[model samples]
Target: YMLARSTGARIIVEFGTSSGISTLYLAAALRDNGGGRLITTEFEPSKVMRAKANLAEGGLIDLVEVREGDALETLSADLPERIDLLLLDGAKALYPEILSLVESRLRPGALVIADNADFSPEYLERVRSLAGGYMSTPFGDDVELSMRLG
Candidate 1:
């Protein structure tokens, strides 16, 4: 969250909103940064409701839009023109497809954080490849952090 704020990130897209734990972090950053938008998706209706409630409780619901549906469908349209940060922590198998959907909108130097990336070897391979258009490396233990270069 601090990293996103430090980089002046105004548009954040998160693939999973499980109870809004991560959403609160991002929303707090947006609040501290004055204002911003967080578009988060969750396919499970129950989780969506819980996340929304959590966001509301955190007083950050105004900064976030919790979309309910498979992210591939929910996040396919109405995205920000320039996405600053992307968090990929949903269905691990769909990380590549999610990235594909948002790749064109990622500004140069955009940051992508994929948690539990080891579950998706293809995603890891794509991001680590020189031809992938991103400079990527493992972060901490299970996270793969990539920066879009193009």
Candidate 2:
């Protein structure tokens, strides 16, 4: 979250909103950054409700929009013109596809963080590819952090 904030992120798109744990963290950063939008997706209806409630309790619901559906569908349309930050923590199998959907909108120098990236070798490979338009490396244990270079 601080990484996103320190980089001056104002438009963040997250692929998972499970229980709103990470949502709250990102939203707090946005709030402290003087406000921004955090668009997050969750496939389960129950989780969506829980996440919404959690965000409301954190007083950050206004800063977030929870899209309830498969991320491939929910995140495929109506994205911001330029995304400053993207967090991928959804169905591991769809990481590459989801990245494709958002890749064109990523601003130069934008950050893409994929959690549990070990489960998506295709995603890791794409980001690490020499022609992938990104500079990427494994972050910590399970995360893959990539930055848009163009």
Candidate 3:
């Protein structure tokens, strides 16, 4: 949300909407920006249904697109891949996949915010490997960090 608010991002993409906490923040940011769109994907259909209802309740159905199916697969070349920010809040095992997807899609200086870094070995390694352009937030948990892919 800070990214969107600060940068006035017009296009944002997020993976995983388990409970829709981050989704709400993102949607609100987009709405408050006067114009923006957030496309969120979840593998499970049930989760998508719940997320749609939750987003609607949040008064953000129009600004958000809840896609049901494999998020990685759904992220086609034709879709809005050049994101201002990409949030990865799901499956640790898919960290590499997420990174690859971002690499292909995200624009230079785009931010990739990842979750559950401490618990995921693959994610940690990927972060380590990409240390050239990545750094953790110094203030708090350090779990929520950003990388400027240039």
Q: Kindly list the per-residue Cα lDDT of model 1 for residues 81-145, writing each as its tens digit.
A: 99999999899999999999999999999999999999999999999999999999999999999
lDDT of 2 by residue, 72-102 (tens): 8898889999999999988999999999999
TM-score of each: 0.98, 0.98, 0.85
Q: After superposition, how far is residue 8 of candidate 1 from its true place, in Å?
A: 1.3
- Candidate lDDT values, in order: 0.94, 0.93, 0.75
lDDT of 1: 0.94
Clashes (backbone N, CA, C under 3 Å), per candidate, total 0, 0, 0
Pairwise TM-score winner, candidates 2 and 3: 2
Model 3 lDDT tens row, 10-128: 78888888767788899899888887888888898778888888888989889987777787787654467578888888777786687777666667777777787666676666655
Q: Residue pairs in steric clash, candidate 3?
A: none
Instruction: Name the runs in model 3 displaced over 4 angstroms.
Output: 130-132, 137-139
Model with the higher lDDT, candidate 1 or 2: 1
TM-score of 1: 0.98
